[model samples]
Target chain A: MSSPDDKRRTIRDVAKAAGVSISTASNALNGIGRTNAETREKVKRVADELGFRPNALARGLLTKRSHAIGMLTNDTYGRLTLPMAAGVSEILVDHGVSLFLCATNNDPRLAKLHLDALLDRQVDGIIFTATRIDLEPPPELLKLGIPVIYAFAQGPADSVSFHPDDAQGARIAVQHLHTLGRSRILHITGEQNYLAARIRADAYRELAGPSGQVMFGEWSEEWGHSAIDTVYSQSGPKPDAIFCGSDEIARGVIDALRDRGVSIPDDVAVVGFDNWEVVSKQTRPPLTTIDMELKELGHRAGLAILGLSRREKLEPGIVRLPCSLVARGSA
Target chain B: MSSPDDKRRTIRDVAKAAGVSISTASNALNGIGRTNAETREKVKRVADELGFRPNALARGLLTKRSHAIGMLTNDTYGRLTLPMAAGVSEILVDHGVSLFLCATNNDPRLAKLHLDALLDRQVDGIIFTATRIDLEPPPELLKLGIPVIYAFAQGPADSVSFHPDDAQGARIAVQHLHTLGRSRILHITGEQNYLAARIRADAYRELAGPSGQVMFGEWSEEWGHSAIDTVYSQSGPKPDAIFCGSDEIARGVIDALRDRGVSIPDDVAVVGFDNWEVVSKQTRPPLTTIDMELKELGHRAGLAILGLSRREKLEPGIVRLPCSLVARGSA
Candidate 1:
């Protein structure tokens, strides 16, 4: 626990301790300029002894690499981007990199403004993220000379993209329910417009076969509660398990079922997608949901961009990360 | 809409249009070196006509002012900080100032690392934010020379601090419930250890008087659900209105009431604090809650730091911004 009064070891401190010029110390540390090997080794040793850390700014000026990344996002609510941002920051900070986060609010003009600003600041590279997946990068971002990595979203066909595997997440949820001896399962999810909803539904159908029921509605708790009526009204046997597209919908379903005198995981088991902690963890029986590994996606995105910045070879195209089931009390 | 192909006007463009050397144009625009008044005026006109935006990086080299600020927070989830971040960005972007965001994740070592990094980057100022209120800045941030502003949290006694008025928010929630002609009101909130919970509870007592029942518990939906049992078990008349500390608790309360066949508004109206959109707006009846105006606090913090950077006079104390009621179906 170093006190605030404990001044950080600066290049000046290292120079003073090594009895050398600041530039000599800096050149010695960075392996540039005309410094002798013996002097460089001595400077390095002194720097290490004093815990002297070179300022990235001074290093960046010589290398033309700011070691800072611009993270452009349009996720205003930060529902998806926050975790991704956290994950990206988690890895980048260790490399003496900082993040410049910009929210474009999905406006092309705003996006361009942010892009230009970040470029003017001379960020090492850019990582563009979104709340949902897209097939291509924005038209303006296509020609950027700097490296770009898309996380929780897609970029151009040839660009590196990272996103959650919704199909696998759906499979995990359904398989978990099946292992619990629940055969009559119903899939109630968000609107059909979302690619995630469709992918999850497709996976559910393939795994559950003809007996599975799939209903698409808005991603709202109200819809989740109302869908219960439609499920019970069908002529066939009532579903013994329900898989919701989102935690919000799952919460609604759980509450509505409980209100009807049905015991969770006793009369029926329910599972959800996007194991959102605030909602999933607070549910009556808590929620057994799919963890999208968004943070991990972010972590990979950070590493991929760093690699690209160093001109390291990387595979392009969409890279779907795995999703797994988070077992809680509900299932 | 302007196409992405339309490149932003540069100083070179202005110089060419004004028929002056690049050095002369730079001197005139920045008001540096030897430049005649007529030439400076001519350059200014040409620059204005061309919509020339000065390169901050270039200007930074001479003035040592990057016009950049670092926003450091420990709120990894970004639940409270996102809106504040958005608000800060909203104000600072217009001034051509960019933000460097770092999440410390409540690690003192990480906090020190981030602070040192930001300082090394030569940021003009720093804004320290947190998930909860603190009486002072972290021990590591005490001695930084650059301007520092606190948002959604407090810093040193002499620094400008901006935070939500929890007491005012509680007053507004209580007053709204009272105006609805609901006398038997109960305050069900989170743990008493939280400063927010205590302030809000104090305000509730003053506004609702001695009769106002206050129950302190965990900040969870489960607590909200279980509190209903405690309230109903009492011999006296049931509460006609419930004011919750957070929207999560309100959602639980609303759901529990609905399950018990108690009609919302007609039987018991509910109000909540922190008008969290995802939780409040998605509630069954939609929660009427106290809007803490956290974004506004962030905006103010940004402005205060900008002002301080310019050596402008500002009062040093905890500035509590007023909270307002957001009327919805719940109350």
Candidate 2:
């Protein structure tokens, strides 16, 4: 019996067993150029009998395509990146592509080093993801010939990018609340710095009209709690519904409302954004929120890059994917 | 002016400029075999100026070392695996090692395919992580010569494995509660099927003698809320301190207690496990809980694999990393 430590069978072993030259055996096994059908079959049979496995690196060197993707990101928490990566992987795997993950931590030098290293490895393409929106990918990455797709963030003006339709997501939430007869809707949101926060706030203003109460603060539960106090302290009537920037803020609003003897949905229907499962599902009465469909965005990005790799021309512009409302107990 | 599509400088370009043979230029650039010092310096200077990047796959084939690792995980949510991966990447990057990430999703065939692909790519070693602990790696992996380290899971009897010391973590939680002068400490945890749940329950019984209360159900927040009702319905004395199996459970307990007008850290103190930042920090009063030290476990696991890759002998057994206590407002 062969021991487990025995060296793996090599192509040379197949060649010797088949009584053929190394070049003939290699050509027959790889189906490179034309060869006799009988000889090719015999070489393949010999290789299978010996359990010979071809070296991917050698094949990649010869073909100039590694069939691997370099997935670069600064999102260490994997909040959006994880699902996005899963979608990308789902598409890429079916195409026989593997992903090499690297975190740049927003460090320019580290990003350059990683980019160079990945380029040296001859990856077929690259997918760049970020925690926040950016105007463009680093200039160094644009020069590389490999296909590049930016997901959950913007890239250069000439590059293709994917992101959620934040304005549309806000509209869906407001429409849902409106359908439930919640007119006096207060908009409580995070800081004005984030593009997402501003976009959603603008959407709320357009959809909920000029009289809608809009407050911007930190993206925290504490902010959500305090915003309620600020609203109630005002001279006008209290809100019958609240559209929060995030599930965290919504949780705080619900808790504060509950503490003040206000019943969820009956007294003040609440809606949140991001539909984060942990926070949205665990809240008392649960939470109805906007789902960004990040995975779908990533899946489209994967397909786009695969197309680019095949020399197919692609439109260079932002593709804003549609968002959906996940209705739960609260709203 | 250069367009974005410009090709990167190649070794042949460097050699042509340096007035030397390609073989000599390559030997000088890579510091391989014997080469004259003057020619080496000239080639290095020319190569740097041209930005000649070497092909890593070619170098790997020559050296028989890829300087890359395959990280195979089935943890799709990235709750534990992400932190572990970050730790692994930290060490690997410092040593000029790249990571190849693959999610097998508990499919034996998929796992085998990934393993073969990684091997074909000439990865130096492999790290296997899982959604839960298991007795051994897949039988297909056992035959490979590459070093394999199991993290947050178990491997074969003679292989190295790393996991959190669940029993010790429970001891820490119980001891902390005891230090707070809590006599009637109630333990509310998740399902009885989980190894972690069972280990913590056993530890609670040992440390609390015969008087401690232990309840097991779902790992959901709803379960925590209902368990409180069950406890108070037939109880002699209500628990002064509650130790929850997870932050979600603790959050429910805190919310329910607050609704009943129970002052946190005054009428009752609460502690939790997992120290999940989002849940723990967002509680009415932040939770004081046990942290599994997962990142550190991952860092150590990375180092262990690095050593193993270098053929250094390692102690073959489960290395139970100690968990730590993170104190906040609740306790």
Taken over the whole model, the C-alpha lDDT of each candidate is: 0.86, 0.85
Once superposed on the true structure, which residue ranges of model 2 sit more than 4 Å away at CA? Answer: A1-5, A15-32, A36-46, A135-139, B1-5, B10-12, B19-39, B134-137
Which residues of candidate 1, in runs, are more than 4 Å off? A1-19, A31-58, A135-137, B1-20, B28-56
TM-score, cand. 1 vs. native: 0.91
What lDDT is reached at residue B86 by model 1? 79
Per-residue lDDT over B98-210 for candidate 2, one digit per residue giving the tens place of the 0 to 100 score: 88888776777777778878888888889988866643567876767788999988788888989999999999999998999987888999988888888899998899887
Output the lDDT of residue A199, model 1: 90
Indicate which candidate wins on DockQ: 2
Question: Against the true structure, what is model 2's DockQ?
Answer: 0.61
lDDT of 1 by residue, A212-297 (tens): 88999999888899999777666867889999999999988997898778899899999999989998998889899999988898
What are the per-model DockQ values? 0.45, 0.61
Question: Model 1 chain B, poorest ten-residue lDDT window?
Answer: B1-10
